[model samples]
Every structure is written in C-alpha cells, then in structure tokens.
Target: MNGTVTELTVPTPEQVARAPKVVLHDHLDGGLRPATILELAREVGHDLPADTAESLARWFAESADSGSLERYLETFDHTVAVMQSAPALTRVAREFVEDLVADGVVYAEVRYAPEQHVEAGLSLDDVVAAVQQGFDEAVAAAETPIVVRQLLTAMRHQARSREIAELAVAWRDRGVAGFDIAGAEAGFPPTRHLDAFEYLQRENSHFTIHAGEAFGLPSIWQALQWCGADRLGHGVRIVDDIEVAEDGTVTLGRLAQYVRDRRVPLELCPASNVQTGAATSIAEHPIGLLTRLRFRVTVNTDNRLMSNTSMTKEMTALVEAFGYTLDDLRWFTINAMKSAFLPFDERLAIIDEVIKPGYAALAAEGV
Candidate 1:
C-alpha cells in the first residue's frame, strides 16, 4: 500500500499577522487608501470611477486582476492623478508607512517614480523631499519600531532613467535607499537604460530592475548580465529556465543556476504575480519550487491596493498555499532584510535585534 499523505499544519491568520515581515518591492503610488484617494480626488477636482471607498477599492482589485500586466498597470492612473502636489505626496507617503506598521512590516523599501508625481509642476527634488517628510513623520509617530526607506524608480519607457539614477544617489544618505526601472517589460528592455545602470554601478549604488514578469528569459538575462542589477523585481519568470522531471528530480539551466548560486534576490510578489498573469495562482506559484530549491526568495506585495493585499495577507496566503510555518516566514523576512540596499550594518542590526527575536517569541507561543 502507498504511504498516506499527512496534512500540513498552517499558521493561523492572527499568528501570521503577528509575525514580523520585511518587504523590498512595494510601490508607493500603488498602496494609497481608497478613502484617501476619494478625499484627494475631491480636492484636486479629479473624477473617479467609484464614489465610495469600498467600491473604489473593489474597482482597483477587480481592474488589476485582468491577467494582463499592461491592463493591471492602467489602474494607477487614478492614483497617480491625485498625487501631484507636495502636500498630497507627503500625506500619501506618511500614510503608506503607517499602514506598513499596522501590517507588521518591520522594514520596508517603498518605491515610486518621482517623475510621475511631477506632472503638477513639482521638481524631482521637491517630490523626494515631500515624500521623505512623510516617512519621517510616520516613523516618529509609530508605536512599534519600524524602518522605511525609499527607492526612486524610473519608467522603463521613458528617457529620464539617468536623471532618476542621479536623484537616487544624491538622496541616498538622506532617506533614499536605491534606484529601479519599472514599466511594461516586453518592448523596452533593461539594456535600454544601460547608461543609467552603468552610472549607478560606477558610483557603487544598488538598483533592482523590473524584469521576468511581462517578458521572459531574455529580459532577465539583460537585467542581470548587461545592466548589473542588484536584484530582480517580480522575477517569477526565471522558472522558465528550470525543468522538473517525473521522478521529482530538478534541472536548472545556466541562468537559473547562476541566479541560485550567486544568491541574486528574487523579489517575488505572489498575489501581484497572479494579477499580472506571471503565475497561475498562489498554490502553483514558482515561489513554491524556488523556496524548495533554496533560491534566494523573498515574499512581497508589489502593489498593496491593486493586489488587495498586505504583507500579512501575502504571508497568510502563502501559509495556506504552501503550509509555511513561522520559521519559513522568518526565513523569507531575513532574506529580504539581507537583500535590502541599506547599509550592511543597519540590515544586520534589524535581523539580529528585531526579526530573529520577533520570530522566536512567536514560535514560543506555538504560532
């Protein structure tokens, strides 16, 4: 007779929420509160599809779940429209950190394209200053000890990547953590921004490229081989280079093997992956196989509002799908902290002083 399969024990939602988490790929513009959007839209005289916060929230979730990355990104129009002025940027940035604190994110690096917010006649420096003001206010007010930093993103379709990379370097000590390029990945490859990437590398600055989501292996290869990215954003498509056999043996192509061997962090967002059609579902996500293979995998919520998810929600879903315990969750959190662009000492401090102890306490409670 075949051996019986034992059911995996999953952590409760409450326990999962209480566990400490770190997120490296959240979007600032993609995480505004619906009620805040309503108020901002009213002040700015912008129209919205839904009048009520509940309906607006529903609209974002439903609109982003269209299974196309381009369609999913279109939902940001409303969010970006309302976030034009300094006051609006500051308010949104502050509330973003507050929400992260509530979601049990001990450390996070929220990113957005400052160029997008400058449509209302603000300079890039003004935009960065306002957002930093918000982050400072929220950190000061938080009851729990949480650290939030900024990653300035350049739109891949645009030509301002070099300027944005310079902005990130100028603000690195002042609150900015790194740089990134994000947009539709099919036509405009990461190599298009090679000048900006080379500039960043020469300055010893860290950056992550948005690749392997809407595109395939070539995008990943360019981001890593040509651009010298420190990390890969939504790199779920790396699984395309991996093969599994009927006997459960695994084979890794050169790229996949390089990724694993070099410990190039994959900033995976499961719910967002499903919304963008990068993965079919959370249960069948490449994260499952990636984690099993000991890849440098970290869980994230790429867009909280669009994906209708939080760090806790993402972690809870993974626990339900993969039967992850507090230990697995802790490992993901540490991997994120280690992979963060913060100073090495600061990252080590968080892992040793905050994350490790937090997980130990939760495990002590049998969570």
Candidate 2:
C-alpha cells in the first residue's frame, strides 16, 4: 500500500443542514406547516382530509406520491382553500420564511398565485400586500438574516396571466422578485401565455416556466424558444433529448445543447419530480447526468409539504444518491444564487460575502 492516506469527505446530515442554501422555486401555498394548516383550516371551517398534524402531513405526502402530475397537483386544493383571507395569507407567508431560515436557506423566492387567494373577496393587490407584510415581518424577526422574495405565478389553466403579470411588475420594486407560469403542462402550453411572457420581457423582468416536469421536451422548448423563460422550473425532461450509446458515449440533441450552451438554469426538485413521475428515483434522476454535463443545475424544493422536503433534505438526498461532497453542495448553492431573480450586485454580494464564506467555514470544519 502507498504511504499516502486518502480520507473521504462526505458531508454529514448536520453539515448539510448547516450549509447555506439558495432555493429559486419554492411555492408559498405548497409549504405551510401541517399544524398551521390545521389551525387555519379550523378558523376558516375548511374540512381537511386528516385531523391531526401527523396524519395531515402523511396524507399530503401520500397523496402527492401518485405517479401522475394531475393527481399530485390535486393535493394543493386543501392548502389553497385555507389561504383565501388576508390574515391567513400573512400568517402562512410569515411562517414560510421562518421555515426557510430553519432549513439554512439564506435566499429564497417563494411563489404563489394571487388569483387563487382572491376567492375570499380579496383583490389581487390585497393578496400581494398581505403576503408581503408577512414576509417583511418574518425577515425582520429572523435571527439568521434571510432574504425572501415573491414570484407571482399565473395559473396556466386560467386566463389571468396578463393581469397577474402586471401585478408582478407593479410590485417588483417592493418585494416581488419575478413572475412565473405554473399548473398542469399537458393541454396548456407556455405558448398559451405568450402575451404575458412578452409583456414581462418588455418590462425587463425575469421569469421561469414550469416546464419539463409533467410534460416532455416540447414543453421545455415552448417555455424557452417561444415564451423566453429566464429559467426552467423542473426542466427534467431535457434528458429526453440526450442519448447514451452502448459504450456510454453521450449525445445531446440540438435543444439540449442550446439549453446547456446558454447556461439556462434548471430548477430541479428531485423528490417532487419522483412524486410527479418525472423520474423514477433520486438515483435515476437526470440531475446526475445534467450536473455532469455542466447544465447549470440548481436544486429546489417545489413543494415542501407535498414532497416532504426542504433545502437541507434535498441536498442530503442528492449526497446519498450521488455521493455529493461539500464541494458539490457548494456548487449547487452558488449556481442557485447566480440564477436568482434578485439584482446582479445583490446576488454577487450573497455569493461573495455569504455563500462562499459559509461553505469555506464548513470545509474548515472538515465536514
């Protein structure tokens, strides 16, 4: 044996939990705590599937684990039902930020559809204001200094994309970071919201499209080529364009090469993807090859409640599946920071001042 000793440096669960994380595609309505949901539902007389917090949490996870995107999305009905009033919206948003702080997320963009919250007679602007109030309160109270922003998502099945886009731009200077188009991706393509995407583009705003998770490459193509999405939310289907030969040589189709060449960020949620039938498991997820090919992959928790995930949990899962070290985790964090919808200088400051230092400290700990 050689005199040199090699020590593997895998990050422990604690180290992963402590490492600074940045998430670009978290949903506000999709992340309420089980206990909070129970309380809110009780106040609103909204009947839930389960009574206890433990059972409610289990119900959400089990319901979303169905191998169908439509079935998975059906789980959000209960969450959205309880968030109609202004106070409920504010409370949920505040708790959302607190949860992110606990999960070691230094920066996050939480998204929700203002249109959905208007069922309780709240105007679109009222919903935005209420959510922002909660965010401001939580940020002020957070001891760890977290930056949270909003991305107004226009549901694809609805025709209010333009109105929501306007609302997002109107609040952009306040706390809204960007805009997005979400919901089922099968019948309703991103092209259906071309006008809203074009408007945001003209306003010089950033946006991501919920593209490749449920559908395939066409969904991704329309989101990028037709709608001009700045980032792809769960662009897992880009793998459909990639082929591996019997000898293990990989080939990328034109669209896949274009995505990589342009450095388009893929907001990948591993657990959520498996739940929605996008990938079979974490080990078989396309993130492994996408990261290997340098496709600007960024980890995200699409729905913390539904997928039963957080930034820390997602990182730990990736580490177990792919043997990702601290360096890999740092790379993912920095990639997300770079791709964030925040101002370039602000993103740089977090990268230079916060993320880099945080990872360096972890490295020093020999984790």
Q: How many Å off is the CA of 149 in candidate 1?
A: 0.8
In terms of lDDT, model 1 sits at 0.92
Error in Å for residue 19 of model 2:
0.1
Error of 1 at 254 (Å): 0.3
Q: Deviation in angstroms for 80 in model 1?
A: 0.4
Give the poorly placed runs of model 2, Cα more than 4 Å off.
1-8, 68-71
Clashing pairs in 2: none
> Per-residue CA lDDT of candidate 2, range 1-367, in tens?
0111112457899999999999999999899999999999999899999999999999899889866656666778899999999999999999999999999999999999999998889999999999999999999999998999999999999999999999999999999999999988999999999999999999999999999988999999999999999999999999999998999999999999999999999999999888877889999999999999899999999999999999999999999999988888888999999999999999999999999898778877773
